[model samples]
Target: MNSNHPPTPRTLPTAAAADVPTFGCVVYISTLPDGRKKGRVANLDGIEHTAGTEREVLQRIVPVFKKRVSECLAAGDSVPWIDPILEIDPQEQKRFLPVHL
Candidate 1:
């Protein structure tokens, strides 16, 4: 399998993305085995930023994401309105919201 793309094409509702002019793309954050936090926003052209914490990694990716988007637009590429999607995995539903059932 090509490592260039993610295992799955994560997505979100178009309306949700349209609501925010600058849609929140999928920034996959994971805890590295070394204990350092890694934040990767593939929609931003395969960018992967690592820092001590998720917050710090986010701080680093924001500006970069904006810059890459701007460049894509300037180059006449379609607005990456759909690339970086905000999707919630079913398995992670509990982590996001607990249900009393």
Candidate 2:
């Protein structure tokens, strides 16, 4: 190895790299009775966050959802992923969020 040259970066094996998982879930946003926006994960029961706006609700929920996924993976439990296609009421809005650890 030449002292003036930088070392080449090594790539991880495909399978090994894939082991570090990426999680995704569907968040459904709906207006509450009092007009606040509520963001609820489609597959995680009781996992919800509320804020004054759609953007704020999403910002609040993503971290909480990521933490839950991290905890599950740390404990060797399966993450609760949302379905590819979820049926929702017409009044609700939805978005798919990917959680990368």
Candidate 3:
């Protein structure tokens, strides 16, 4: 992998008054065409599956998230500080994300 594009660590937990971590990451998942779905955990692109069910998609994603979290902890990756993504409407997928890019 290019050093310039390392996988991002998902949102970190909130810090305590002292001796607490101040970094984190975020993961986004959405359904796709023809019973397919996709997502990103940290910077790692997720697997595409044709489960055709929301519960199946969730089942597929759990392991991906867990593995990435382990990697992030081992690497001590810093989560970028930013406003949280508050709105996630599946209907407006194109507008919600930069599909062209």
On TM-score, the stronger of 1 and 2 is: 2
- Tens-place lDDT per residue, model 2, 1-101, is 79998999999776644556677768899998999998888866557889999899989888888888888888999876655545677889888887777
Pairs that clash in candidate 2:
none
After superposition, the stretches of candidate 1 with alpha carbons farther than 4 Å from their true spots are 1-20, 80-101
Ranking by TM-score: 2, 1, 3
**Please, what are the lDDT tens digits per residue for candidate 1 over residues 4-82?**
9779877876654333244445576777788888776644456668999878987787777777766776798975554
- Best lDDT goes to which candidate? 2
Q: List TM-score per model, in order.
A: 0.54, 0.68, 0.39
Q: Is candidate 2 or 3 superior in TM-score?
A: 2
For 1-101, candidate 3 gives per-residue lDDT tens digits of 67999798899778755543322334455666765655433333443334566556546655654555456667898423235443445552321121110
Model 2 whole-model lDDT (C-alpha atoms): 0.81
Clashes of each: 0, 0, 8
Count of clashing pairs, candidate 1: 0
> For model 3, where is the 10-residue window of minimal lDDT?
92-101
Number of the predicted model whose TM-score against the real structure is largest? 2
Task: Provide the lDDT at 59 for model 3.
Answer: 61
Q: What are the Cα lDDT values of the candidates?
A: 0.60, 0.81, 0.46
